[model samples]
Target: MHGLFVSDLHLLSPRSACPHIETELADYAGAHKCIVLGGDIFDFRWSDRGGHDQTLEATSRWLQDLQLATENTDIIYLPGNHDCHPDFLEQLEKLSQQSKNFSWQPHHLQLGNNLFFHGDILDAGNSLEDLQRYRRQFHHVKPQSQWAHRSYDTAVGLRVHKLVPRILHQPMRTCQRLQNAIDRLNLDDAKAVRNVFFGHTHVPIEGLKLNGRSFYNPGAGMKHMQLQPHEFTFERAIPASEIPLASDTSTKPPSK
Candidate 1:
């Protein structure tokens, strides 16, 4: 089945990923039998600590609605940098267990030599090392105990509640540099991979090739440049405003 690949939805971001926009996306996704969400579908960093469950429920409503519109369609979510928090994973695991059309893959997935991931592989280190780096950049990690991680995340949650739009293009550049380094690193598994689909970069680029392999970045589903007026900032969804959901302005699917 041909799959619709989406990335960087950042559902919690006020600057992007609004109800009307996601509803439009759901309409497009309904045309596909399978849906692969590469990463950052949800930005836990923006979740209100007190109203965390309410936030998750609100973000997931559109997904649930989409599933109903396209029965039997599989929606696979791969956690990205913005959604790698332990609390988010635990909630996702529960949702996947309860929802028939939903499932979660912790790491990358391979389909006929095509790799699907959140595009974090281009980072400085392995997953653990990356986690360490994440703690430093986003959260305050303690060497004392594993419990400290959770406590610090609570603090970080309130402090860093949204993505910094100023660095929006950084991930895109990093993805490009990583593409160049792939050949330099000479990793056999990487070489064997023919098609790589990732979405850490909010920049939408399709059919980009490097080192004879096809690379695609579905870009950020939520943070579309066309929707914004000036620079991308904390712009919330204005339903009454003149916001075209899709570039083509397609009709949305029935949110049954």
Candidate 2:
């Protein structure tokens, strides 16, 4: 099956949504059998779209439109720390009930031998319990001031956020953490999983192998000059030789 994976859009409103990339993404969705929204697709905590009710309404409407636009494709959404608010969860549940093509889970989605998640659980050490607790904290976050967003925009413009992560090798660290977390979980289908796909670190991984399993991250889509969502076909196996190392400074983006 053909699949498209993306994460960390951090969509606040039309102003920050990057409509051009979204247009491309919509086309990609139409062409794929399924699309997994890895997480942080909406930015509730820093949303400039208005207060809670307005932001929720806008995001909900956008989701409904996307669902309608991609009628034949399966849409699987896994909420990240930023978008896991209770009201958003309710909206996701309603959409899942109303649309056969739409579904959402709080943590991860597994299809065939591929696994997809938001990856926040691996951020501060590999702990599913910690991720849940962190997500719970998202419910209490109030929207930040305009100045905060401005400072963030400045950092992005200067590429500090991207550079720091790369220098520190955040992607490899995250992949290692994920491998440890997976082993501890001892999932019944662990043997079936071959590829692990995740986001939230905002570092794109073409491919990184650990313990015989491959990992990938599509990077963040939020006004960053990184690679966009990546497409994969489950029918074809990934070639190890073609994958680049995280240390390939000339080819890979900054880490984390």
Candidate 3:
């Protein structure tokens, strides 16, 4: 079976880009057996506060449409930190009830020889570290209002643009950090799997090897002018060497 993988869609209703992504994903799902959403499927906090009810309804409708269109394909939704609310379980239950193909799973999933995670728990070389650092640096300046979320997001966007090129090209430190995380995970006898997929970096990277395993981050569906959002398809019968690697290393911007 062939599978599709995507992450960091950060979908919102008013955003035309997100709708386009949904349409594209639906088309892709027609040929794939499964679609794995790595994480950050929604910017829930921002949507809850900044978005109107129409946005919520539209997003929900889009999801339903995708579920219907991809009836033969399994849609796996993994919760990211942004969408990991206490009520997440209830929300997912509602979503599952609304669509036949849609299902919500825990942060991690094991499929055949592969282990998939939102990659937040890997806790190394993630963009979140920089984002946290910036947040701390401007904590006093940042207001406690909901608008602060947008401000922080904007700041992170600017910083990532400046840093990503340097980071992806000379990524020794980052690669080491990611490898270390993979090593720790492999230490768990039960969870020891060869292939891994993750997405916190927002940088679409493939061909990362650590301790005889491969790691892939499909990047984001949202496009930032500098980096085009990407989608990945994997064939179960195809060997690792056969997959085409992506050349772009820049982070895709959130679709507006």
Among the numbered candidates, top lDDT falls to 2
Q: Model 3, residue 234: what's the lDDT?
A: 44
lDDT for model 3, please: 0.54
Give me the runs in candidate 2 sitting further than 4 Å from their true place. 13-17, 30-32, 124-126, 167-169, 235-256
Compute each candidate's TM-score over C-alphas.
0.62, 0.83, 0.65
Clashes of each: 0, 2, 1
What is the C-alpha lDDT profile of model 2 across 7-27, one tens digit per residue? Answer: 888788332446665566578
Candidate 3: C-alpha RMSD to true structure equals: 9.7
Which runs of model 3 end up more than 4 angstroms from their true locations?
13-19, 48-59, 97-100, 124-192, 222-256
Instruction: State the lDDT of candidate 3 residue by residue for 138-158, as single tens digits.
Output: 112111355665665665567
Q: Candidate 1 versus the native: TM-score?
A: 0.62
- Count of clashes in candidate 2: 2
Instruction: List the RMSD of every prediction in angstroms.
Output: 13.1, 9.4, 9.7
> Which digits, one per residue and each the tens of the lDDT, describe model 1 over residues 1-256?
4566677766754535455655554565543355667767766555443355665666567567766766655666777776665555565666666766676666555544566767665653644345335533422112223354456455445533224432654544655665664444333367557676776655555556766666676655452342210111112322212322111222111111
